[model samples]
Each structure stands twice: as C-alpha cells, then as structure tokens.
Target: MTRLVVVGAGITGLAAAFEWRRRRPDDEIVVVEAGDRIGGKLDRIRLAGTWYDTGPEALLGRVPEAVGLVEALGWGDRLVAPATTQASVVLPEGRFPLPAGTVLGVPASADGLDGVLTPTGVARVRAEVELPPLSLPDGDVAVGGLLRERLGDEVVDRLVEPLLGGVYAGRADELSLAATMPALAAQVRGAGSVLEAAAAARDAGSRSRFDADGPVFVTVDAGIGALPAALVEAARAEVRLRTPAHGLRRTAGGFEVSVGTAAAPEVLTADAVILTAPATKAARLLGEVAPRAVDPLRGIPYASMAVVAIAFPVQDVPAGSGLLVPPVTGRLVKGVTVSSAKWPHLAGGEALLVRSSVGRFGDESQLQRSDEELAADVVADVAELLGLSRPEPLETRVARWGGGLPQYLVGHPERVAAARAAVGEVPGLAVAGAAYEGVGVPACIRDAHRAVDALA
Candidate 1:
C-alpha cells in the first residue's frame, strides 16, 4: 500500500485528497491541517437564522472543472446563479450604472461614460481612435500603467482601479496584466487602441464556444462553505486537525514530514506529499527538502481583507448585485454585495443581507481596528452610498481574513514556473493553491487536480 500525505486541509488540499481516493482507493491518504477546522478561507457564518459565506460567496460557473466538481459531489441541483448580472459603481453623487461592453470596467466604447467620466476624461477616451498605434513593452506591465496610457488617469482611477482591485484585492497599477488579465494583455500587445482591442475580443468571445449569455458565476444555495464541507466528508481520509507540519526532509524511500514539537515530534513518512497551504506556510515546510523553493515562495506577497455581513429589511437594501467603490471615490469600503438581490435563496426572508468588503494590499490598517469599529465604518459607507440616513441594520457580523488574497506581481508566471521546477527536483512532491494559477474556487480545484496528477 502507498502512503500519501497532503498538508493543509483547505479546499485545494481536500480536493486533491478526494481526487486521489477516487482514482486510487487503495492508497492510504492523510490530510494534516494546522487549523482546528477545515476550509482555510471558505467559512459559513449563520446570522439571523440564515447562512452567509464569510469568504468567497460565488464561483466562476464558466469554468468546467469548477462546475464538474460540484456536480460530481451531488450539488448540481442545488446550484444557484446570480439573479441579475447588473452592477453599479460608487461615485461622488451616488451609485451609477456600470457601463455595458466593459472588461473589468475598461469601457470598450465611449458612449456610456456620461456620468462616470468628466468631459476631459471622455475626450481622452475618444482620442484613442485617432491616437497612433499603441506601443506596448516586450514583457508584462502593470494593468493600470497600460490602461492609463491609453484611457488617461481619470478613467483608470475612477473605473479600472476598483474593478480590478475588487478581484485581487490589490491596486491595478501594481497588479501584473499577464497574470491578472491575460486576454486583455494579449489584446493590448499590438492593438492600435485599448477600447478597439477590448471590443474585438468581446465580439470574438461572443461568437465563440463561450456562452456569453450564461451565468457568469454560481454558488450552492446553502452557501459556498458547503462545497468544502461536503468535500471533506466525502473524501473520508485520515484528517488530523490542529496538527501542523513542522518540517520536511527527503528519505531513501520517500519523504518524512515532521509535526508537533521537536522534543516529542511525530514524523510521518510518505511516498508522496502535496502541499496546499499558502506560500509562506509552504515555504517554511519545504526548508529541509526543497530549500531552493523557499526564496521564491517567500517572494510571493499576501493581502488581508475583512467582510462585514449586515442584514436589513428588503426595502433598505440597494438594488442590483452590489456596487464597487472606485479608489478615486475616497471611500473606506471597497465594495458591497446586495446578497438578497443577487440570489433568490437569500431573499424571501424577513431580513435582507448585504456584505461590505474592506482593506486591500497596501491598505490593511483598517483591519487593525476592532470588529465593531470596522462594522460601524462599513455601515456608514453603506448608508451614505444608498442615501439612507443613519439606517440601522437588523443584524451585523464581521469576518476578518488576514493574508487572504495573494498578489501576483510582475514576472509571476516565470516565478511560478521556476518554483515548480525547484520543487519538482524533489521526487514525489507538489504544491497547490490559489497562490499559483488563480484565486477563485474553480481555479483552486483545477490546481488541486493538477497537483494530484503530478504525484502520479
């Protein structure tokens, strides 16, 4: 019998374990986690007799791997799509409708920039057509830098910043285009204009196999937290919670993983090991066997953020999925998701739920405040955005996720490849998580599957 040890019991680790058992049932699998509970970031919080997700609430349904895993887990029927794709952006006056035909708030056409862009800003966008063929650098560039060159600073600040920030929890100017938005990056490579390239790409995608009209995202009606819970339950592997992996070393036969204190440490030898923890944790564990991988892993930075879920009467909640706050707005709250309007399952109750997300890459000071302080600040932003005066909520809850999202800096793709090569030098070792390929649920699942295959 073969022994497989999967470190870190997050979705990625659990998914890898589950896949291993499904394919090789005879193999003994053990999942070790430092935390008492599983689901690293996917947590379910029950408030006012209803369930809400503290981490990611939805999955990119367009990703086949994500959908396939959910259906395979018998959650196909319970899958729910966003009731509406419509979203708005917060401005000085109030919330304004996000323009159509925009990719991550980069408008493909200048027609919808009325309320969002100033007269001078609109002129800068209109000049894109007349502007000479854009010259892009040979390699990866910051998303904001590229867009600002074409669309002007105002558009990048008012539109592109928030949309991209909402996804990676990092400023657009600092995020790498190749790692964050490859499609747009490709378009920007040789295109004469950014808007023209975006328009062409959108048109091509609409006419391709991609379902442009399909639901962009989906989630389990109960909550996304259920997915990981079901995964852990179904995997039925030997799960050791509150037991962290302390050390790793190569052995003649395989590898030895150390846990607990050095004085009375327990070591488990395995033919294969899959590390699915964050970059920092994974780096520390690889110190003995794959020392070279540690530097690159440590180079990867993480951003912390907090989510405040508040419930109110249906009438008090704003319409639409939610509104994103452009950095130019000078707002503390980054974004807000009107849960009730987005999902019917979250509606029909006496109270409607709204979630406010705050804190980002370089702006984590807000997280230093107490939960009450954070919740109060977010509530004030919500009230002001919705034009409600001192509107009290029926209930409120705050969930803090320190080091939640990973920042994919420039040269990320090359860095990831080099890290993989360094770890691959050590036989029967692999790493998986959102830090590598993607941050969404589907990306994590797909990454896990690849890690499992690597062990084979």
Candidate 2:
C-alpha cells in the first residue's frame, strides 16, 4: 500500500485526504496540522449558550465542489439555505437595498441604482454605453482602474469597493480584473462597453443552474464549523495536531518530510505528498525540491482581519439581513451580518447574533486594538448604522485572523500557473490552498482534487 502525507489539515488538506480515499481506499494517509485543531479558519465559539461560527458562515451553493462533498458525506439532508439574502449598503444618506442586475456592484443598466448612487453618478454610468467601445488590454489590469475610467469614481467607491471589500478585504484599485471577476472581465474584452459587458454577464448568470429564484449560499444545521470534524471522521486519516512540517526533501523512494519542533524533530517518509499549507509555509517546504515554485508562492501577499461576534436581544436589533460599509465612509467596521436573520437555524432564539468584520489589506492597526476595544467600536458602529439605541450585547467574542485572505493582484493567475508548472516537474509533489486559486471553500476543494489528480 502507498503512504501519503498531507500537510496542514485545513479544509483544503482535509478535502484532499477525502478525495484521495475515494480514489485509493487502500492508501495510508496521515494529516499533519500546525494548529491544535483540525479546522483552520472554519471555527466556532459559544455565544449566548449557542454555537456561532467565527469565520466563514456559509459557502456558495452554486459551486458544485462543496455542495457535492456535503452530499457525498451523507449530510445532504442537513443542508440549509439562508432565510434571507436581501442585504443592504450603508450610504451617507441612509441604508438602501443592494441594487439588482449588477455583477459585483457593477450596474448592468443603471436603472435601479438611484438611491445607491448620486444623480451625477447614475448619469456617469448611463453615459458609459454612449462612450467609445471598450476592451481589456493584452495583460491583467486593476479592477478599479479600468472601471473608474469608464464608469467614474462613484461607481467604484460606492458600489464596487464595498462589495469587493466584503469578499477580498482588499481595495478594488489593487485587485485584478482577470482574477477577481473573471466572467465580467471576459465579457469586457468582447463587449462594446463596460455596461454592456455587465449586462451580458448578468444575462449569463440568470441562465445558470443556480440562478436568482434558487438559493445561492448554503450551510449546515450544525454550522459550517462542524464540517472539519465530519470530514475527519469520513476521511479516517491518521491526524497529527500541532505537528508542523518544517522541511521537505526528495528521497530515492519518494519524499521525506521533517516535522515537529526544531530542537526535537521527526521525519515521515511517504510515497506522495500534498501541500495545503499557506503560501509562505508552502514556499519554505518546496525550497529544496521545487525551487522554481518558491518565488511565486512567496509572492502572494495576505490581509489580516478580525471577526467580532455579538449577541443581543432580538427586539433590540434592526430588521435586515446585513449591511456592507464602503471604505469611503471611513468606518472601522467593514461589514455586518445579522446571523439570526440570515440563517434559519439561528432564528427564533432569544439572542440575535450579529458579526462584524474589521480591517483591510493595508490597514492592520484595527486588528492591533484590544479585543474589548475592537468589540466596543464595532458595536457602536452597528448601533449607529442601524439606528439602534446604545444597547449592550448579551455576549461577545472576537476572532482575529492574521493574514487570513490572499490578495489576487494583477497577474495572479500567471503566478499560480508558474508555481504549479514548477511543482509538477517533481514526481510526487503538489500544492493547493486559498493562496493559489479562489479563496472560497468550494474553490479550495476543487483545487485539492486537482492536486490529488496530478499525483494520480
């Protein structure tokens, strides 16, 4: 039987192990995680006598990988869609419903964006179709740079910035058009105008299997944090917690991995290895065997942020799913999610759960504040934005993720391709994680399967 060692037992690594077991059930698999727990960002905390997810609460149901995995694991019956996805954006005037017929806040026709954008802003977007025909250049370009030139600053600052910030925690001016919004980017290259491109992209989306009338996002009744443990049980791999892989080298048979503390190290020999660690850690391990992959892997930069989970009396909270705050507002809290309103399972509880995200790519100072201070500031912002009285929460918890998100800057796809090509040269080496491809759970799972397939 073949022996395989998987590094970093995050969702990506655990998903790799699961896929491997399906393909080769007889193989021996050992998963080593640097952390004490199996789940990395997908974690939970008890608040107001109920379990609340401190990290991502849901996955895009439109993506088949995560949903398919859920079904394969026999939890299909437990899958729950959000009760309400009608989110709003907090503008200087007040909160307004997120405009429809838009692809990531880029208006398709500028028809329903009256309150979201000023008269001048709407006029600017309307004039986009009348301007000269637009097309993307030969290479990657910043999402904001291209849109701002065609659609004006209001469109980017009010609409695109908040939406992209909620997803990437990075500025639109720095994010890549090709990497972040691939479909819209592709449409932009062929369409006559930005508005035309957005409309075409929206049309394509409406025809998708997971279109508007169906649920777009989903989570389990037990919470997304429970997925890791369920995955561990299903994979049945020998998992070693707090066992960090320090170095890797090629051996005659396969590869040898040095793990554990530097002072007292241990080695594990395996026929194949799947690296699911973050970009930096993966770069260090591939230094000797796959030196060509190291630079690109190390080039990926990360952003730090904190999630402040608070539980308040149901009546004290506002009546909305959530609100996205744009950076132009100069607010410390980037966005707020009303958990009780969004998830059906979390509803009908005495305490209304809410989560606020703080920090961005370049701004780490917000994360440096004390947990109590951060929580208080977020609470104040939420109360102010929702027009709530100065009410105290029943319970509060703060979870900080340093370098939690990878910035997909211009040329990210090329960098990932270069890294993959270099690692493919080695016989039994592959890499997969949030750094290389998409940051969502489904994307990570898809990439994990790709890595496993490479080895097979």
TM-score for candidate 1, please give it.
0.95
Q: What lDDT is obtained when candidate 1 is compared to the true structure?
A: 0.85
Best by TM-score: 2
- Indicate which candidate wins on lDDT: 2
- After superposition, the stretches of candidate 1 with alpha carbons farther than 4 Å from their true spots are 204-213, 261-264, 316-318
Question: How many clashes show up per model?
Answer: 0, 0
TM-score of each: 0.95, 0.97
TM-score of model 2 vs. true structure: 0.97
- Tell me the tens digit of each residue's lDDT in model 1 across 351-397: 77889899889998878999988888898888777665436888889
* Least well predicted 10-residue stretch by lDDT in candidate 2: 205-214
Candidate 1, run of 10 with poorest lDDT: 205-214
Candidate 2 C-alpha lDDT tens digits along 1-456: 999899999899999999999899999999999889988899988887787899889888886888899999999998899988888998887788998778999988879989989999999999998888985679899999999999999999989999889888999999998889988987888999999899898788767744356478998887778889988888889999989999999999999999998887999999999999999899999999999999998888999999999887776455568999998888999899999999998998888889999989999987888989888989888777766664577888899888989999988988899999999999988999998878888889999999999997
